[model samples]
Each structure stands twice: as structure tokens, then as C-alpha cells.
Target: MADLTFTKSTGLLAWPAAGGQWSARSGPFGLGALPSGVYAVGRNEVTDYTTSICAAFQDGTGNGFFVPIYPGFSTTRGSIGGRLGIHPDGNVPGTAGCIGITEHDASSFHDAISNTPANVSLTIEVR
Candidate 1:
């Protein structure tokens, strides 16, 4: 079976009014169902100042997978790296490094985030 994990790995938590799962800011958000396999999401929650966002997964001891940052939201062939990766351009108004999707596997990456009260949520799936 395929498992999906959502995470809010940065900036501010953009949630709804009633308080529920999180979503991305403005701009183009990526959406897709990942391949059937084990994956993990990680990010540093925004507190005071200074923050870095990255997503990676390790299947086994030696096998490690690193998420790539898609440039210009281009889905063209012969790009930088293989495999579908999420691409973030710019958020509402004028913000950078916001959440966005690229591959079909990243459809649920924002489901774990909460925007309202400002809270980060991380979801993980094994097998």
C-alpha cells in the first residue's frame, strides 16, 4: 500500500479559520501521489529568526534519498535531476522559499501544516 506524509517545514503555519490541516501560501503548489515506498520529511520550524528547509528520505542504512529544488517550476525533460520533485517559486505578496509541489508524489506534503495559530506539523509514513 502507498502511504502519504505531510509536513510543515518552515516559515509560518498557514492554516484555515476553524483550525485543521495546513496548506501552502500563494503561488503554484505541487500535488501528486508518490510511488509506493517508504519516505520521510524533515524541516526546521520557524521560531524567532533564521530557518532552513530540506526534505530527504533514506530507505535503508546506505540508501539515502534527497529532495531536489525544482528550478522555475519547469517540468521539461532533460532537467537537472531525475525523479519528480516539488518546486517553490514565490509566495503571496513577495515571499520566497515557500511550500510548493512538483511531482505527483508530493500531493499531500502540505496536509500536516497548520496556518492559523502558527504551528508546524510533520507526518511520516513507513511501508
Candidate 2:
């Protein structure tokens, strides 16, 4: 699995790299600034969202990146939470509850976590 950190304010997805440094990519998350301290995403297994608005992404995955956020929904998000994932914001303005990566780097982001052979689960902290 991969350990990642996402900054909601800036829509930056960051992760530790081979050395002691961190690598990151920027994009948009959520249709608007929903709220902070929403919830942590325990995501595993990156999949391609073929039906997504950005499904046209030319990533090797053949579509857009779609990693299901664990718990499926957030209890921290009031009474009813929404479906969430990590995908590329290709065709639209922004996302609903999912974090979006730029279309250009969707594949790299997909490989970054999907290719790792260390852990069983991927946990991402949204700051």
C-alpha cells in the first residue's frame, strides 16, 4: 500500500519518495471547500472509472483513476456521507466528494500506489 497526504486547501496529493524527500501532484478536490477534518480515506486497489466524466483520460488504466475510499462513506460528514474516490478531473469543473488529480498525471498517480508491494492497505490523510 501507499501512504499519502492530501491538502484540501490546495488539492495537492503528496507522498514520500525513494529518498527522504516527498513527491506531490496538484489538482482539484470537491466541488467546493466542503469542510476540514472530514475523514481519512483508507483506500486500496486503484481501479479505472470508465463511466466517470473524465473517463476519456488516456492513462494506461484505459480510463480514469478511481480508488474507493474506505468506509464507503464518512460518518464525519453529518448524517449522510457521499461516495468518494480519487480520480482525475478531466471533463468537468470539480468533484463531489472525491479528490481529483490532473488528467496528465492520472496514470503516474495510479501506478504510484497500485505498483507498491509493501502493505495491504492504503491510508491517506487529508489535511
Candidate 3:
């Protein structure tokens, strides 16, 4: 399985095996930064925006953090059941509590990991 690392300090998600990296913009006011730890990428699903793909961040105990985009609406911390996931979107407003990237980057990220079997481990380190 391929391993992915996200550094909160730089808002960058790195996939060494893929030989590339992408900028991941976290929530405004630091509300979107994921807790530094190891997590698993759960089932692949479509985002609320209906134009991108996403998956859940599992805490290794059946709990999931799903990231959803509200577009023009403001997003608050824990608004969506404290669920956060990786999705496609720019580092702009309305992403107050989710990690997002440009649509192009999102597609690249999705393609890199989407084929991985479920329960693939992904480590996120917040510094």
C-alpha cells in the first residue's frame, strides 16, 4: 500500500511514491487543521459539491472525519459531525474546517489513492 503524509505546518500533502506533492489548505482560523496522527482512508465517496471525489479519515476505531464543502456558505467547526475528509476545492473561504486543494490537484490526489484498497493507512502530522 502507498503511504501519504500531510504536514499541517506547511499545509502540504506528500505522496513520496507518486513523486509529487500538492498544497492542502486547511480551515481558516486553524479550525480545519487535522489532529496530528495516523489515520486510514476509508470508503471513497462523492463530495457534497457533486463535482469532486472524497473519502473519510478513519481514526482506527470505526469513527470517520468527513470533509464537506459549503461553497458560498460559512462552515463552522464540527458542523458536519466532526467528520473530515480530503476533497477538491481551493484554499478559500467556506472551507473553515476542511482540507481542500485546487480541482486539478484534487483530481491528481484522487487518482493516486482512489484505487487503493479500503483501510489504507494515511498519516497526518500537524506541527
Candidate 4:
């Protein structure tokens, strides 16, 4: 299991002691901003589009919740509720309350975690 952190203020996602930093900018949440707190990145899965890696977020009740990160999609893609994961596209409005990075950076993120066992626990802290 790998623990990751996302600092909303700086739009940075990082693994402690990891070599590089990744971007994870969040989208608007409801009438204001998405609640800032800790979230768990559940089981990792391949996106339906087959262009990025994804994982469900566990809510306070430990149930799968929110949109997953889909860092491989192009900038043109938009959020589609639970059907679509968060893409790395820069357009914040398209995120729909999910974190985003860039296709190139997402590929690196995938490689970083690919070696870990399936369903490895990931912690995301939105500050």
C-alpha cells in the first residue's frame, strides 16, 4: 500500500520520499469548494477508455465514493458522474469535483504504483 497526499492549495500530489511531484488540481464542489480532508484511494482499475489508471475513493463510511483519478485522458474530456474518473486535463470545470493532472504525468504516476500489489491503500490529503 502506498500513501499519497494532495495539497489543494498548491495543486500538488506527492508520495513521501518519492522522486518527483505530480499535479492534482481539484474541481469545483457543489456551490462552493470540495471539502478539504483525507480520502482513501481504493482499488486501482483501468479506465473504460483504456487511456488512464483509476481507483475509487472511500468515503467516511469506507464505501467507494467520488470520482477516481483518470490522469491519461486528453484535456478535452469532461467529468460524467461516477462513470468517469478524474482526468489530468487542465480544465478545472471539466473535473467536476475530481483531481486532475496531465496525460504525460499520469503515465509516470501509473508507473510509480504499477509494481505495488493490487488494492494497495492510498491516502489522499486535500489541504
Candidate 5:
């Protein structure tokens, strides 16, 4: 059996604009440490101006699944500071942001996500 790990941390991340991209360094879950099909659930857009809770994951590829993990489907603005379930492959499938997982140098990507001042709660359960 593969070694599975579950780690949790708290910090903030900045969500870039449509043409921009941002990343968070969740715990010590390195780049390749997390399988390509990993899932992420937490707050996305955060700011005194805007906020949102989002859940996203991949299917062993870079294609990601994203959804509004907040109030309702119609509600698109809010902030979430709580424990989120991050699974390599969640038991059930639903609507969420699924993005292609890219394998990169762990050392380089580390601390990239939580480097922002927006403070958040992050959890990464690896399998």
C-alpha cells in the first residue's frame, strides 16, 4: 500500500485575476508529494473587498474541478475559515473546479501558496 498522509495548516493566499495565477504552499505536502488527482477545499477569493469558499481538485491530470463551497450555488461571494477535506480522490463526485496537476520542483513551489497576508485555513489529506 502507498503511504498516505493527512496534514493541516492555516494561512492566506491571493487569487489572481482572470489572466493571473496564484498558488499556496499547503503544509509540507510538497509538489509531487500530492498525487495529480488531489483535491483542495478552502477559501478562494479573499479580501476586505471580496470573498468566496471554493473546492477544487484534479483527476490524475491538470484538469481541475471547482465549485462554490459556500452558501448556495447562486451565492458567489463569501469567506471561509475552517477545516476543509482534501482528498486525493474524494469518495463522491460533484461540481467543483478540476485543474490539471503539474509536477514541479517541490522546493521551488513550497511556501508559494501561504505566502500571502490574507490568512486562511488549509488542509491536505494525501493518499
Candidate 6:
């Protein structure tokens, strides 16, 4: 199993939660499901794109953070297409090939990942 997992069939982005089996953020990925495989998550979140408020993107729903996503050593893909990341959906309807937290639970989820110890690496598996 993967430490963090996203299921393309249902568009569910999930990770283990305290006292629970897992936690997830589900929503539509506009472009399509990112290639199924394991990906590394950046330790810190960045607002460079989300807060940019580029009318062409977000449609006025971006004001959060997203962590950079990369291919992991155990990934299933030879190469991932374009840039991949995950962020809060926050009233937005879809994403550009990235995972979006649509259940309005991104705040907590973001905090959890952000607070992870710097030495600890994060990886996500997309199925």
C-alpha cells in the first residue's frame, strides 16, 4: 500500500488519518487523472500558483496552497506528464491534472502535510 493514495476511478486523494484508516479529498481533475503511480510530495506547500488569481485558471476559487508532486523511486511510470500537484478545491469545480480537495476539508489536510517533520519524506500513490 502507499503512504498517500489517490484513486483515479473515484477521484479520491487519500492519506492515513489519526485514529482512522485514512482521509481523502475527492473532486474532478479537469484535464484527467494523473498517470497511476507513486509520487513524492514536497515537504513545504507553495502559493506561487494558487494565490496568483490568474483568471484563466482557478476561476476565482484559488486562495490556498499546493505541494509539488514528483515521481518516486518505486513509481510505476517511466515519466509523468506535465507538472503534478495537489491543493484545496475551495469552491472550484475542477483541476488541471492535479488532485483537488473538494470535501472542503483541505485546511486540515494541508496542515497535516505541512507539519510533517522535514526529514520525513511524503509520497503519494495514484491508482
lDDT of 1 by residue, 11-39 (tens): 22222332433332222222323222223
Once model 3 is optimally superposed onto the true structure by TM-score, how far is the C-alpha of residue 25 displaced, in angstroms? Answer: 1.3
Instruction: Mark the regions of model 6 whose C-alpha exceeds 4 Å error after superposition.
Output: 17-31, 45-63, 73-82, 90-92
Ten-residue region with minimum lDDT total, candidate 6: 18-27
Window of ten residues with lowest summed lDDT in model 4: 56-65
Query: Whole-model Cα lDDT per candidate?
Result: 0.28, 0.53, 0.49, 0.48, 0.26, 0.59
TM-scores of all models?
Answer: 0.21, 0.62, 0.57, 0.58, 0.21, 0.67
lDDT of 3 by residue, 10-124 (tens): 7787878767587766665446555555444444443233323222232212222233322222344345465565655442332445565533435556556655554644444
Please name the candidate that would achieve the greatest lDDT relative to the true structure: 6
Residues 1-127 of candidate 4 have per-residue lDDT tens digits of: 3366667788777877446577666666532333455555543753322322223232122222233543232333233344334345442332456665533435555455555567566555656
lDDT measured at residue 110 in model 2 versus the true structure, 0 to 100: 64
Evaluate candidate 3 by giving its C-alpha RMSD to the native, one decimal.
9.8
Q: Please provide, for model 6 over 1-127, each residue's C-alpha lDDT reduced to its tens digit, 9 standing for 90 to 100.
A: 5678887676666677521122233334544556677888877644443456443233224456667788765543324444567766545466666676664434556557766677887788888
Candidate 5 Cα outliers beyond 4 Å, as residue runs? 1-97, 106-110, 120-127
TM-score winner between 2 and 3, please give it. Answer: 2
Clashes of each: 13, 1, 6, 2, 25, 0
Question: Can you write out model 5's per-residue Cα lDDT over 1-127, one digit (the tens) per residue?
Answer: 1111222122212222212222322322222222222234343532111112122243333223322222212322223233222212222332122211222211111223324333544332332
lDDT string, candidate 2, 1-127, tens digits: 3466667666677767611222233233433443444344444456644545345233334466566564323444323455555666555546665666654546666666666663555566666
Collision pairs in model 2: 1-119
Question: TM-score order of candidates, best first?
Answer: 6, 2, 4, 3, 1, 5
Worst 10 residues of 3 by lDDT: 53-62
Report the poorest 10 consecutive residues by lDDT, candidate 1.
56-65
